[model samples]
Target: MTPHDYLNIGAAVWLFVCWVGYARFARKRARTDHCLASVLHVYRKTWMIEMLSRQNRIADTALIASLERNVSFLASTSILIIAGFVTIMASIDKVYITITALPFANESMSPRQLQLKIVLLLMIYVYAFFTLTWAMRQYGFCSILLGAAPAHDADIGEAERRRYAISTAKIIDQAGHSYNYGLRAYYFSLAILPWFFNTWFFIVAVGVVVGVLYRREFHSTTLRALVRDLTATEAMKKSPNG
Candidate 1:
């Protein structure tokens, strides 16, 4: 093993740390703050509240079905991607030749290095597959909850209705969180591609990926809009006629 080899391992470890650390940190913050996830959580709660007020739930059912379909599609695509990675691993000789021929690729990569890169990609996709499948299952659970939800004219008390809505919203929020995790895995997998070129490039690519994710999650215009909307909604609730 050389310096580059050690750096490659370090880069991979750092990438994994960022993924897990950010997820845990964001989950904790989302419980009380106004990050994108928290804003979405508010929206989910509002949705369930409105859903319980509606006379007909066809629209609500349609919305949940649409969400499930999206997760199912991504989960299926991840399986295909994992299969592609496995195929690439079986034909490593051709892949190595092609990669080495790239203009800026490091030509000194051993067979082991190439295999490691492919394995990293495979593992990323595998993680994505699991996340997405779990998201799909969670969505299914949400659908079941929706089906069992108290109707607009049910005899349930206001407190019970509120509790049911919050519980259902939390389940949907968890599904959304799982889907986001799967998407994050896909985003980070882009960093793995540069590993086939050089360890330094791989590290730089991981930094770029992390920066992009941070910006979108914490500083994007969308987050600002959601926060603004939430503030307005709260203000309206505090008004005398509200």
Candidate 2:
């Protein structure tokens, strides 16, 4: 293999490491840190608890439906993207010509190399489709759980009510996690698009993607606002004004 081949291999490996490593890092940090996932989990629990007081659960179910719709939209869009990629696959010759003309890629770029890059993107979208659809189904399951929950005026014990709310919120949280994973795949996929032009560009893009993800997940303004709001809510709950 040539030096260019080695660079390609190294870049691909870097992408794999960044994608998997960042996912693991983010998840572990979320357990002990104040990221969007962890902070929103508290909000989900509070939402479920609030549902316990409403005699009509239409609003609760409606919220669940809205979440499901977002996942469904992404899943369907993934299918369309996959289809477009498939169509592109049928015209690999044109892709090879176009990519080879790029100053960075040049005439030495093999058709197989171009095909592999496209396939990598296709695989990402396929993985995203599966993850998004599963999340959509999980949201549906949350709705069922909500439906079976005790009525507002039921004789259920406090302990049981609390347990039920916790379980329902857990389902919603997990579904949100799955949705996040799907979005992560999409982010990484964007990094790969540069590979056909330059391997080093691809590697740098992967690092940039990781950086963006970390900042958004852990240090975004939205996260700060959510954390602040949650803190105030907890402080209010502990006050003795009542």
TM-score for each candidate, following the candidate numbering: 0.95, 0.97
At residue 120, candidate 2 shows an lDDT of 89
Off by over 4 Å in 1: none
Looking at candidate 1, what is the lDDT of residue 29?
A: 68
Give the per-residue lDDT digits (tens) of candidate 2, residues 1-242: 99888878888888998899998999899899999999999999999998997899998999999999999999999999999999989999997987787776735558988888899899999999999999999999998999999998999888888899999999999999999999999999999877877777788999999999999999999999999999999999999972
lDDT of 1 by residue, 33-63 (tens): 6788888988999999989999999999999
Cα lDDT over the full model 2? 0.91
Model 2 spans with C-alpha error above 4 angstroms: 102-107
lDDT of each: 0.89, 0.91
- The global Cα lDDT (0 to 1) of model 1 is 0.89
Query: What's the distance in Å from true for residue 41, model 1?
Result: 0.8
